[model samples]
Target: MDSIPKKLYHIHRFDSRSGLELYLSGKEDMVFGEDFLKFPMMNLHYVFSRGFICGNLLIDFSIGAFIHHLYSASNIFQDMIIMKFNEKCSMEVRRWHGDRTGAFSWTHTKTSVEELEGKSDETQDKELNLKASIKHIVTCNLEEENLAHPLVLPLADCVISAVLLDVISKDEEDYMRNLEKASNLLKIGGHLILFGLLNTTYMTAGADRFHMMKYDESFVRSALSKLGFVIDYCAVQRRRNVSDLVDYSHVIFIAAHKEK
Candidate 1:
């Protein structure tokens, strides 16, 4: 008798609303306030606000990339391209960017970013800039030969991937392959920003669970070094809550420059 394969969740099973409500929004949730939220606001604040060369073209190979946090990038990069892994994610972003009614509310994220910046008046400006800077929100397949196949996307000056590989990759080999694909999308000496979940197997969303690849800081460092990326900054946030809402021991953020 043949063994039955375990059913694994993919982007097809992703619940964007539940994800927003559970993990990405609200300051009340410890998981959102301390771990996940802090990862971007802190890491990106350091990179974009500082004297880093944000360059003209930026690409984010992650779902819900600018939907929640990291709104500050719009002020730095000349143009941004968000490559969504699935149509549903793309549509949500389009709705938000287009200012369509009934779009998912991101007011909490906006407030968090404003609080971090120590200003409130520029929120509308930031939103407008973000909507204007994003030139495309095209569909992508990370496993494809060309991640944004048939689109002739530009080689980015900087690339961001947050919690994307751990969710999509089945193992270390797959992770490395995807990492190489990300690096390939950048120009030489370009920047690569990474956000990762540390030491976990599964995450829950509205009573449904999804598998995640378990990885550590050392693995991340080794892989980046092997790929000829010089680490500029790295920060890790250890788990602060033991709630069953999310399963992860830490959140890792990294900024690396592709040397070759």
Candidate 2:
């Protein structure tokens, strides 16, 4: 008899509201802050602060309702579009965007970004700007030929995703296909920024375990090169703390442009 593989539904039907409280309440979330939130937020601020990837429109396709990484982006892009694979995450973003009751608090993350930018007294204004700049929060299917499909959207100047492809894809080919699908949303010469977990097989959120597609920097570089993306900036941060929530060894951020 063969052993059975456990069912994992990490991102498929995630509870973004509770997930945020559990993993990223920030001030008291030392374990999660060190491994997951801090590095990505800091890196995103650093990347966007350099003014290398700014444009008219920006597309965000990150998993769950995680928008902590978008604080810096609010200053760069004039128009913003967020793509969600599931209704749960989609509604979660909308709830916060609409200022509805029971919305998750991102005040800590906002403060973190303000400190990183060395700015003060304008946090509320910045948050409002991000909210106003959001043109649409549309649904997307990464498996399709056109990521958004039916409702054709203008090609974005940049597409940024965080820790998504790893958990959503079943294999390398699946991952590559999704990459190509997402690439279709980006214009030629536009930039694509990706944040991924390296050498991780599984992750946990709100008592549910999810399967993650594991790959390394070399694999990602080869995939991007084959897809005609010119790799420009790549950074990998090794995990510095221990946690049972996710088993990722490092967080990798790559910035590239579509060459053709």
Task: Provide the lowest-lDDT 10-residue window in model 2.
Answer: 1-10
TM-score of 1: 0.92
Candidate 1 clashing pairs, residues 3+ apart or interchain: none
Q: What is the C-alpha lDDT of each candidate?
A: 0.77, 0.81
Over 4 Å off in model 1, which ranges? 1-11, 27-30, 64-66
Residue-level lDDT of model 2, residues 1-260, one tens digit each, is 01323334333566666667766776564567755677787877887888777789999988788777877888888899999887888899999999999888887776676678877778778778889889899877665677788788899999997877887888999889878877878999998899998998877666566788889999999998989999878889898878777778888999899988
* TM value for model 2: 0.93
Candidate 1 lDDT trough over 10 residues, lowest sum: 1-10
TM-score of each: 0.92, 0.93
Instruction: Using lDDT, give the best candidate's number.
Output: 2
Give me the candidate number with maximum TM-score: 2
